[model samples]
Target: MKYLLDTNVCVDYLSGRYPAVTRRLQAAAPDDLRVSSVAVAELRYGAEKSVHKQRNHERLDVFLREVACVDFDRDAASAYGRIRAALEAKGAVVGPYDLQIAGHAVSLGLVLVTGNVREFRRAKRLKVENWRRG
Candidate 1:
């Protein structure tokens, strides 16, 4: 199964906070690992603002090299718009970046691995798996 590692999952793995999930992630086939551009952007944003900026930056680089970075292409962008509209129509206030990530996962047919399941749960169409729960 293709797994799209979410921002929080990546953070937990890098910080060694979730050893079980980290071990599973390490043991998984490299070809099965994926990450959305939104997650990469979030990591970069965190690294830029972190007190240990250099260390976090290095860690993010290594993580990026290990996983395939899925870009937000035309299809994914379209999906994002649809997801946003649908959620808004349902009276949900979904964050822009979260919608983008959800859209990318849906467009790529990837199961999102995240800790913040409730946030992404707003986009019910996107398949999400909480590594912490597993």
Candidate 2:
């Protein structure tokens, strides 16, 4: 199955928080793994502000080389708006970046791989697969 790694999952992988998950991600087929452009932006934001900025930046660069970057197209943008509106109508508020990632995943029909399942759960209309789930 095609899996879109979320920002948190990418962070965990790079930080070595979950070795099993990290290995799983590393061993994933190239065609089955991807990262949203939104996630890349988030990594850059964190890396820029981190105390170990150089290390983080280097890691991010390497990570980018390993996973396919999914860009936000017009369809993804429209999907983001629809997802945001639908979640808001349901009284569930999600972060702007998260919504964009969700939109990209949904638009591309990819299964979202995330550690922050609770945050993603807020978007009832978005299909997500928690990497933490066994």
Candidate 3:
């Protein structure tokens, strides 16, 4: 099984801040772990904003080495369109990046691992697991 980790989950795992996500990583196959380009961008965005930019960049480098990055391409755009419409029609609000992450997961047929489950669950047909909630 494969999981497209949300930005928050990616940061949590890379920083070794969450025991649950860390344990989940130890149990899962390294190859089965994946992340989207949007997530990479999100991580970099966070790193740039933090006081310890150099340290964060080092951590991101290590994280990037271990996890494979999947691009946000045409198929993800199509998935975003569908998910956006679905959420709009239902009056559900999600952050733009979260929507993009969800789109990437749906497009790739991978379960989305996120800490913000409430917003992600609003995205119809997108499977979400909260690795941070354990």
**What TM-score do all the candidates reach, one by one?**
0.94, 0.93, 0.95
- What lDDT does the true structure give each of the candidates? 0.88, 0.87, 0.89
Cα displacement (angstroms), candidate 2, residue 13, comes to 0.4
Models sorted by lDDT, best on top: 3, 1, 2
Rank by TM-score, highest first.
3, 1, 2
Root-mean-square deviation of candidate 2 = 1.4
Report the C-alpha lDDT of model 2 over 1-134, residue by residue, as the tens digit.
Answer: 89989999999889988886777887789889999999999999999999999999999999888888988889889989998999899888789999999988888888888987778877645677766543
- Candidate 1's residue-wise lDDT over 87-132, tens digit each? 9999889678878888889888889888888878888679999877
lDDT of 1 at 106: 88
Name the Cα RMSD for model 1: 1.2
Clashing residue pairs for model 3: none
Evaluation by TM-score, superior candidate among 2 and 3? 3
Q: Which regions of candidate 3 deviate over 4 angstroms?
A: none
Off by over 4 Å in 2: none
